[model samples]
Target chain A: MMLNLAPNIADPDDFYAELVNSQRNLDEEQALRMNARLILLLANHIGDRTVLTEAIARARAAG
Target chain B: MTNHIYPKFGYLRSKEQADGVVKRHPIVVIGAGPIGLTAALDFAARGQPVVVLDDNDTVSIGSRAVCYAKRPLEIWDRLDCASPMVDRGVSWKVGKVFFHDQLSYQFDLLPESDHQWPAMINLQQYHLEEILVAKCRANPLIDLRWKHRLISLKQPADHATLAVETPDGIFTMEAEWVIACDGANSDTRKMVGAEFTGQFFQDRFLIADVAMKADFPTERWFWFDPPFHPGQSVLLHRQADNIWRIDFQLGWEADPDAERQPERVIPRIRAMLGEDAQFSLEWVSIYQFACRRIDNFRQGRVLFAGDAAHQVSPFGARGANTGVQDIDNLAWKLAMVLRGEAPEALLDSYHEERAYAADDNILNSTRATDFITPKTKVSRYFRDAVLELAQHHGFARPLVNSGRLSVPTPYATSALNTPDEDFAIGEMRPGTNAADAPISVAGKPSWFLHCLGDGFTVVTFGKATDKTGIAIGPLAAKIIRVGRDIEDPSGLLAARYGASPGTTYLFRPDQYVAARWSGFDETKIIEAMLRATGQDSARHPAGQKELAA
Candidate 1:
């Protein structure tokens, strides 16, 4: 399966703000783990190994 | 409750007090703890006179600050004290982390070989102090004054005078420079009005040093929510003399007094060490730690090092290791400034570099504290998730925070570092501490770090040559030709330093890389030394062609 290249979420700016606000008042470690949990939850929802592997590769390449 | 007996040195009246005259010394170190005594030893190594004052005449009561890292051992080696420590201390490299009786992850601190010292060692603070005190007593350049307490400090325009109360009487003494190594509750810090600020943890940990004859392996074992103590963290480490140091986390609501009693502490130890294990209680104490540092490490003619300047949680074994590095970065600069080889502004870089390292330590300690004692339910859930994954996955292993074992902090953004003229490889950047390797000096077996003198060193990786005219401003740079003067038998030194035939490296007095170039350039080397000594203010922008020109 091919990982989607185009933006998929509606109102991307609002979603980004909400994603950041989810970690409000959290310490650095707490916020990092929260992000880790968020990634795991989203990966479960996607539920595609090939897509997840491609996404991971893309993330690594971007960094 | 401690089984070990404390050694005491009776107070003696100083000749200055007997003469009823105030004497001014070159350096005055307050508090004869490990840091203060080490400072005195460092000054003596440079052939400078130092007077060390302590309120008491004995080593500290409890077995505090047990773990000593490799960097500090190297520093002690320079002062001719590492041999006794390594001989007496228990050294280990591997640490295992468990989550509720299940192994979560394990780590090897020093996977690479060919180093002089081990990754880390565990020896009680009192034992370390006893070793250092003996060294100080042997050195003629050091004066150890026992039972002398500082009453007040007055800093004038020219110098600072300390009024100390001894067994004889209160007397005044002066110093060109004063160092405060008076531990966490520093009276010198309060007297000098140095503002200390940071996070205050609302948790308590019970530290018990137990003497036992068990056959436990000499490795660090940490547990989170184990069966012995549910919903809490426990750390186990081995020290010298058949003693084991155990730290049990008791939440903020636990009573400090009740937790210290043997009746309450024995059951906790029995649950972890098994009920039939015969162990005698050596020492038991309750402590609450904070991750805080002073506003500045230097205040005019007076400076602070060790716990007097910064405080951190004991989780990472950072408390004394970081402090020893502070003194390592400080003493040479102070010597140069005192001898008028460098400008007084050179002292400012001590604050710049050490304060940066202090912040790094505090950040690590704070992160570890937060993970081990999560404040929020969501955070604890994430921590548990990471632990659960760590048992089966490799990626999650990095997320486990069983106190990021103390490592030397690189001054990446220090002003003293000259931008590299050559592309850098490996970890040997401008402000990074020098790494050691196996080498032969003139056909005899020796370590690479043993070749560094107490002055600036210029290492060129080619044949021997007459580099006599090479001098960095007023300071002469000792030239060491690796191929001719020192042979890299296994080529590990050259490989670790990323050196070619003509590669040239300049190291500071403290053995930190100041700058490196692909080829030897006299002008560039001098400029780098000037910049490292805070003599040059011009910034050498990275990747600039002007250096080539």
Candidate 2:
């Protein structure tokens, strides 16, 4: 029913490294496209629209 | 296992030539493929006489349209052919997708269901045609003629005339109504001057049916850049009779004829299945992906169904499945019109609803084709990124679109549906296909669909009373009371259908929910039935304030 925004990844640093390494050889445009795709994939994974809207507002506020 | 031998239905001479007079028929269906034959059988079962015309005398040549989806299977079940097809075909739902030899994700199409049919079945089109042809031959109302091709068509003011070319000579015939179930290259379509316009993907695929003894499970296996075939996608499915359908994506420029040769194809199969795998090539064909449909399916007295009306890529198994649904939608309406029970305007809804379905199928097919064969570098990048992320991330799994396996498109915004007023209770809403639930009929377990016969059906959760009257124009609707007449011991009829004690649901002839209410009101039920049959154009009398209690 509600969103769980807690840290759930087993090894956060290892996942961050893996995600960065996956985009190692991509150019600027490709990297941007990959980021957009990642955002979409994650958004779809967090299927609840309410949580997605909250996450979007929080990220925008931080920026 | 023995190879399927195509049965030949001997050619019958037209009675028009023997009698030297043209006799008009109620319905004349062109093309004896799966669509045409199914329409003829459906018409005959509804007490309408039909004459089927086909150019060929035998069934389909290769295993064309091998995947039969559930919606079409449900329609076929009403015509008394789904059980035989299911008994012979391989029923499957689990599909495994791999990215560069690494398994990415797996999906179950129908995770939970007590429906009468499976989500998908891998059966050869010819096997289905054989069953339909046999059924048509047994029916006294269906006059099937082989080697009788429609060379020309003329639709005058009242009726349509067709020029047929037979083995002996050409003959002319007249019909009250004409249905074109012809294949993609339709002579009827050309004669009517209707254009099929859409996009054609710049990719070719080689489909080879190989007969082999293997232990592969009956599931769809798809691979992107496997070790055996690099830089292209491959699909493998296990059909009946130990035949395996293997498709390898060939680039647009690949020579179709050269690639079909055994010297060229055997090596590819040998690479995929170890070099020593014993197999004999059964059938091989090359095809380009294209998603196209006509502007309209109905033109005056002549109607188009199946591939003649629309076509989609084979990715989602939508071509034949949608065609069968077209028949299920059009048959009852056409019958009612021919009997003068409903107005001819009912035929227009067939065009409105099926054209909507065609657009939906084409959209899904185009998206699948683009995902499989990305046109631009950016597209490929996103596709690859999705695949890469799907391997580890749960969120990315939904982005993998090998093919969005075909499901019945709900007619959510059709003119026939009576909008829900209070709340949407169940998944079976108006304009949606009635979901099948288990129940007991006379103390024996049966399906709810079995109780809802071919005509317009009204089902009530409790006992039927004087208030539960349902009439569609001149046709008297069949009413079924679940708790009183039919026993529902499992309570699934109430649970799945979202029914209360006095809830009533009106279903169209095709078993689509036309309207539902908390309690049966005869006036409201009759109005809904008339609106569903395109009779009362009074625009769904505004509010439901009168039924608050």
Candidate 3:
């Protein structure tokens, strides 16, 4: 299966703003913990191995 | 009074010249460091004559390269030097990482108990060199010349001629092959006009060895921005002979000379220890990090190993461990070529395999250095964020890279590997280093690695097999039937190797998996043997395409 290259999330600005807002007012440590938790939760939600592999490849390529 | 004494090795006279001409040797190693001595001893064990030339007669001065990983220890075990090292060195696998006087996380590298050696040992490099040098001296085939320096080298197609300068006079000697392990500032590399290219991190670290009697547990203790030294990282390791190695991260602008002074260094030590804690300074040096390697490890008849071929920061303990591995990979190939079992083209695989390992080391080291000493404000911000999160969250703990400890690099995509076939059970795939597990030989406890001699070995899980049809050219091959001749009491051999009854494996001299099959197939085994020795082109196993799909 190919990666979902198309825009999946609607209102990209709203999502970006929400991400920044979640980290807002939190200390450096708290912000880091929040991001880590978010990553873990999303990863658990998307537990498909093939999709994870594709996403990892895309991220590495972009990096 | 400190009991650490630098052992002085007696120099041996150069072999007498025949009719006013220097005699040629089969192999010449240019340095007496751990890497050079390891190569010489390995070659000697393989029944190849070797000559080792060094400018100094003494072991390494400081406690340099203090960490010995498991793979190198296993290689040393094959050479019969691992026992002394494990006996003398401080063996530990648990590491505790702290942030600002609070324990952030702790890790156990090897939690399983089936392996013969621990994850790593903390021993001074001099002690290891002393052991290796003694072994080389005991071997009749190894000629070690101390105080002999290489002045120039000329490779004339068939052989390489090296001009050496001794205390008495200069002389010239010829060799079928030359291995340059002369260290970072290698003269042989200069003589060959090879370029070592890489970036140097703009950071300095102070290494202090102190002799103290303390009750601290024998474990690696690392601190990032402790109360004693704010905004810096500190690494503490307990070595043999009541000596403790402490490394403090000094910023790029710190004065190396000032930091090395006893007056300046004592305060830092006192801060870590209480004011009344007693300790004597042993050795101090300042170092900078550089991740660089030569483009090619082999240049015609002369090959480079150890620090001469590549250099990485000491963060991951990759410097000496990887260097020892270089010798491990090259020794068998060189011995095979010298014995005419394989063609000269086989030597190219050395360059291919070790250069890949060097790149792997450099990549890990670079990432660790970048994480530890972040280059920009944004990077530092994220680094501190991750560090802070690591204190509480388990998921963030893996993101913390104080230093990823060194592990053996698998040559998964190597040209010599016959890729994995139908059997896929464990991580022990083709092109991977062999995993050591506890087993029983004739009802006696033994290690599976010990059963693999210094030649291509065919290991079958059960029942002895006569495969006279399999031909590996002029190279020797041994067949080991585990269940029939040997017993796996713990069943670790089968578990770790992913073997079952009638399972078969082809292992190279360096204990790397060359191929595997569910049952003995003479034609496929012969093809794998030829490819592993670089006699035939690398062909992907028929099952590989299916597995990839």
Candidate 4:
């Protein structure tokens, strides 16, 4: 499957707020771990090889 | 002073003091440390008169700045002082990094062969200084004055007048140009009122120089949270005279004075080297480094180089290596400006180019320091994760920064560079340091770097019949025809420059590539030389018209 480039989240602001809220009151180290787990969980959910590679490339290039 | 003997040159009164005359010199270099002495040698080699003043009579007291990189060695080779240093130094090219008890990464610094020097050589600061001081004393043009300090500096646009304190008394002297290599705590920097700003590392490193006779190979060994020192990093390197330099990372809260005691230090070494290892402490010191630099390298007639101009953490051996390159970049520019061959505006490029290098060094140093000693909890976790991943994954190996091990960064964005018009493979581009390849000169084996003259060079790959007269404005560019003046029999030189024949590379006086062309074009070469010398304003159409004839 092709990686989705356009906005797909129905409620983008609410989703961002939920993502931020998930790590609320957590220490910096714990928040970092939570982010890592979140990334791996989302990566496994989208199990398309080409899409995963493109997503990783896009994230690194944006950096 | 404990294990090694310091040689005292002693104080000597100058003839100017005896005559009681305030004489003016061509160039005055402050601080006879490695940087100042090397600058004096370079100036003298260029037939320039120089006077070096230092407060102390002896070389550096301890084994500081251990790792000397390849570029600095090549610079010293041109100055005729690399032989003894290489002879006495412990040359190494392999480095091993460990996480706890397991090996994380291993690297070969110089994989290719035929180069004159190794990737790096570990030598004490004092020993290198002595070798440089002896070379300086032998040169008549270098007037090295020991036990003489600069009391005050007065810059008057045209020249700088310095009040020097000596054994006799305070005497005044003048120099057309003054270079301050007085090191990190520079009095000359304070005198000039230049703003030095950067990040100060909150951590400390306890440098322990211990003399030991061991069977271990000469290599750099670094550890991240090793079993011997849990939660702290350690660096190990072997120097000359059987002295092994070990740096132990101490957090900011560790008491600097209490940690330096032999009672506290001996146990740590014993834990690292095992219970039965025999060694004697040669020197010990707790140092907190700051990565900072002066806003500009040049102020009026006075200039700053080495640690006086910029400071960096001990990681990557950027301290003295970067300092040597600073002098390498500045000395040639100063010589050109003084000789009237180049305009005074050429000196501004010194600050531009070297400050770029200084910023690069500070960034690398800060990154390494942060990785080695993470200030925040998340940073420490990230560093630990990288170290853990480094053992299994190739991608994480590059992320593990145990001091990026000092390689000269190319000034790719330098204004002096004529952006490559012809495609060439490999890393040899405009504004990059010239790489050395083994070649034969005069029917004898000689390196590629040794054959380059003391001025701008056009390294052209051609046969004996292909001789061209190329001039860079008033200056004639020295041409080294690869197949004639030098022979690349193994084809390494040609391969490195990406040339079969008819490729020309214009090199600056400091041996950095200014431009390269597919064929011998005098106009393009002259234009590049004009730009390199900061005469780009004359690089317009009319000036090109005048230059065409």
Candidate 5:
């Protein structure tokens, strides 16, 4: 069972890969991880603790 | 009458035939290179009449530059040209570094940027120019003059008079402001009498574009101490025209006429290639680089931009990319000046902001250049040692990445910023590791969205409000209150910007946080903005001071 972010795209990794792994040099897996780090940092800057938790949880679940 | 038959690209307006003999535009740009074209695109998109002039009749040949940074691509996206550039260009995500043909390590630009739209694209300079020229040509308001050269210019009290040499004769056209985007060896800078000084390389290197048949990795292959060729190492890059850009870093003692014989050059390349590697030469160039910068960006109405302002070695391809960013910064400010939304004094920030960027690029490129061709044996050994450690330690890899490449820059020390609680905020230059710093937004084009209360970001933590009436400097700017709550913030933005009970941030149009205030003495915040924008100070007038026409 998967809690889809959107319809039809069951594997979140596909969209995540497009968003996070579309770039090369920093491999797709690495890009997803880096994007996660960036998201956390930005969420911290925004002072959004809840979003940060959700983001991290989502990232971990996807991985 | 001297007759020069020319093919017209629509925006090429001959001074001989115009509604008016000379019309003063809001912004007058010199040179139609990448920087100038981007400026024109930005300013015109914002409903500004833009004029671009170039001395050359056609686009520049050869792969002069292909590397564009994330920020520059976002600027292109704003111009609606990023899609074409992205589509036409190849995404070189990871680069393979080989020491003596043995793979040492691979580094990727993707993870660094988090797979943003502004991914590193290997499109040629011709592609960039083609898109820019086409965009400019379509704009009726943008008068792009090809083959028209700016011989000399005069900046008087109100306007600038450019003595442009056209096919028929010298034509005089007055402009409100002039932005010079001439290449590194800029002639427009000379007329303004601005001095550019920095590092000049002694060794002249050869870059030959060969259409190689071999199917090497699409990524950049940097061979350090190629066993076959001890003295000269090969740097290969795939260009758009199915040609490979090969740079043979010959030692400083080589003669200038090395490329005169392709037979001699072909064999040096043949050693590295497969037996069936067939290729033909597209273009070969000999260049000695200079890591130099101008003293100032603005001289009255005439502003120097791009290579005219500064030139760094092409180690990281920061030369064209940085220069293009200068235009992006200046274009909006210039549009404001013309539209009368902001005062002419607002233009002064162009010098202040980009001069710092120029200084930063020079330092970055110089370090990279030095790393590639280590002048001293000690430095050479140290760089090689780092490469060696890079094999064993993950910590060492980032150290090499930071050596000579475009990193996001933070505006920490900028006069625009004030002392925030986080002193670390003051160090973000455009292309430094500071750029690696996280802004509040995720999966967004902006490095940082700056969740300030929607006024000029005054970074001073306390009391920026009380000094609101104080004159900061030439850029007379006033602050507005969007009334944001830092501590008890509600919304994704409030959480991201840390809009807590007392946290605050000021954001500029480019989305850079101007200043973050933690409830400090408001005067210092006002003082900083005044000084930064050239307002709040009596040196330049605030609002409604038109050019003395």
Candidate 6:
């Protein structure tokens, strides 16, 4: 059975938007994506290479 | 015996004594916070020498992370002192949201599985630390030193040299590696020139643990635009000692001190409650959270974990959970490299796997925080709209909860992977391949293997096959009889992971599944293990295909 795979739990592209979304000026979606990016960037900084590569793949898997 | 650690010699001392006692360990964990201490416990459980240091005079007495998730409880079980924590903690499964004194929504957190531990437990963070401190104290190998402040740290080829300022004076200690479980403001990370770049919220929130009386429902309650609180909202969580953690989302520009006055805070509560309520404030903290991460977890022999690596808002309880996972990924591997069993590349995977996990945690928490407490005018409007819609539409509630946001991080696909379908999606790959070791030999071990949550076990089957990675450990291999229906020795593993016969699993001194293999392809599986533990898999019992095949 060929099943469609969803993205990995950690997607990096949404990094910046998720971090700053909490700002009263930013939209909720923007803040969420900012929050997501901040998390991804931090992980990238930590050198969790395999998880990072896989996370990138997870992000790309959808659609 | 040659490599075992003695607790009294390991950690939590004044800066001066530690400066004088020159010693080397695979990892020297700084700061015995929940995450830091968990890392030390896992490292010690892996039969490696570890020295843990903390500058705090006592076990955390502050309003740190009080909400314990199910995953962390699993870790505490591995540390061999979960009973006290479970006994003292309160389990809350039912929660509701109230809008202006009317109950709007309710939900249950019990995910179906045949496990005994509740999904979420409420205990003081200090209580959890107290239990962990006892476990760390019991471990002859995990050293716990409190009140020892880290002044300076240098990363060398073989170790990260730490110069700590303790009660006595300055002293130096050498370790094969240094793992920083330091807080968000890590001096070690700063000293190594790693930049923590991200958003710092200008808005401040008031988090108060209080004892109160009111007609409000006794569940996890969230109020959206209550009468008195026109703009702000309240999050009430019942905690130990008849205390409730209340968070008021005071906008970024509001005066912090004004919210503290009994005249200011109590009237607001009374106005919303529709009656007078008596309450005593336990602790009130103003937190302007940061969504930040250090650029890298490692610089030479030094590594970062916990809050030192990444920080997120308190929503969804991911911060400490992700940090605890940091130790989960690194501890056993450090034990292996120090024991001369695996390659240095294995240590590199810790950063790989955990950094990914940390990344996910930060994003999840960030998303949840943004939704729950929006900063912008549109988001605030949209959030109110979402809540209003939720009041009428059942569809919106679950949609909101889906991203309540959390997951255990793993390296399912990477340079370390074999390109399976599961890996294609970045989900946790569950299969018997060349990589996994069985959880038990008596029966088919669990793929998500645990050692009844204690002690170390090496699992393999078929009258014995010598594996490379199993050679260096405090525990021995679990040899299985492939076709035999033994009483489920690892019933919990079966419940958690659903493993069948002819499987191999290697459980660390902590009960977490280190690596699992489908069957006897010795080299490939050992290679993954070796890579994980910072050793060379190319040496003995080599499997060239673990990565390639």
- TM-score of the first chain alone, every candidate: 0.90, 0.85, 0.76, 0.89, 0.39, 0.38
The residue-by-residue lDDT of candidate 4 on B1-549, one tens digit each, is 276889999999999988999999989999999999999999988889999999999999888999999999999998999999999999999999999999998889999998999899999999999999999999999999998989999988699999999989999999999999999999999999999998898888899999888877898999999999999999999999999999999888999999999998989999999999999999999999999999999998888999999999998999999999988998888888888777898888898899999999999999999889888776677777777767887766777899988988788899889988767545689999999999998789989998786788888887523544566446567778887788988888988888866788889989999999878776778888888888773556564445444
Candidate 3 residues B1-549, lDDT tens each?
Answer: 235788877666665532447778889999999999999989998999999999999999889899999999999999999999999999999998898877888899899987899899999988899999899989999988999999999999799998888777788899999999999999999999999999899999999889999988999999888999988899999999999999999999999999999999999999999999999988888999799999799988899999999999988899999999999999999999998777788899999999999999999999989988889865666676667767887756776778889998898789898877775757888888999988887778888999888988988877647542244447556778777666888888898888887788899999999999888876677778878888663354542233223
Best by lDDT: 1
Give one digit per residue, the lDDT tens place, for model 6 in B412-518: 54344333322222212431111222344455445333433333344543434543334334223343333332244545443333344435555444344445555
For model 3, the docking class works out as incorrect
Candidate 5 CAPRI grade: incorrect
For model 2, how big is the iRMS in angstroms?
2.1
Where does candidate 5 stray beyond 4 Å? A1-63, B1-20, B112-115, B395-403, B421-504, B517-532, B537-549
Poorest 10 consecutive residues by lDDT, candidate 3 chain B: B540-549
Alpha-carbon lDDT of model 4: 0.88
Write one digit per residue (lDDT tens) for candidate 3, span A1-63: 566788999999999999999888999867765665565556546867798788878877994
The RMSD of every model to the true structure, in order and in angstroms, is: 6.6, 5.1, 4.9, 4.8, 15.3, 11.2
Q: After superposition, how far is residue B58 of candidate 5 from its true place, in Å?
A: 1.9
Clashing pairs in 2: none
Best by DockQ: 2
Of the two candidates 3 and 6, the one with more favorable DockQ, higher being better, is 3
Off by over 4 Å in 2: A1-63, B1-3, B464-469, B537-549
My TM-score estimates for the predictions, one after another, are 0.90, 0.90, 0.91, 0.90, 0.73, 0.74
Candidate 5 per-residue lDDT over residues B1-549, each given as its tens digit: 101122344335574434448766677888887888888887787788888888876665676786776667766766778878888876676777766667667877666433346446777777778888888888887888877889989888998988887766677888888888887778888888888888788766677777756677678777777886684556778866576788877777877686536766777677767556787777667777898888888888888888888888777778777877787667767766676645687787777778877777788877766767777755555556556656765545554532355644554466555446554333332222112123333333232222322224433222334434223323333343323212212233333344433344444545465556444445545454544444443344442133221
User: Per-residue lDDT tens digits of candidate 1, residues B1-549?
Assistant: 777888987798999999999999989999999899999999889878999999999998877999999999999999999999999999999999999999999999999999999999999999999999999999999999999999899999978999999978899999999999999999999999989999999999999999999887999999999999999999999999999999999999999999999999999999998989999999999999899999999988899999999999988999999999999999999999888777788999999999999999999999999999999876787788778778987767888998998999999999889887668545699999999999998789899888887988889888535574366446668888887778998999999999888888889989999988888887788788878888773554431233223
Per-residue CA lDDT of model 2 for B1-549, tens digit only, reads 226677877877877966768778889999999999989988987899999999999998778899999888888888888999999999999999999989888999988777789999998878888888888988999999999989999998989998889888888899989999998888899999998989888889999889999998889999987889988999999998898999999989999989988899999999999979999988889998678988789988889999999989888889999899999999999998998777799899999999998999999988888889989877777888888888988878988999888898888888889888647467788989888878887788888888888888888877547433455437567778877667778777788888787788889989999989888777778778778888764553432222221
TM-score of the A chain in candidate 4?
A: 0.89
Native interface contacts retained, candidate 6:
0.00
For every candidate, the chain B TM-score is 0.97, 0.96, 0.96, 0.97, 0.80, 0.81
For candidate 4, what is the DockQ-based docking class? incorrect
Q: Judged by DockQ relative to the true structure, which candidate is superior, 4 or 6?
A: 4
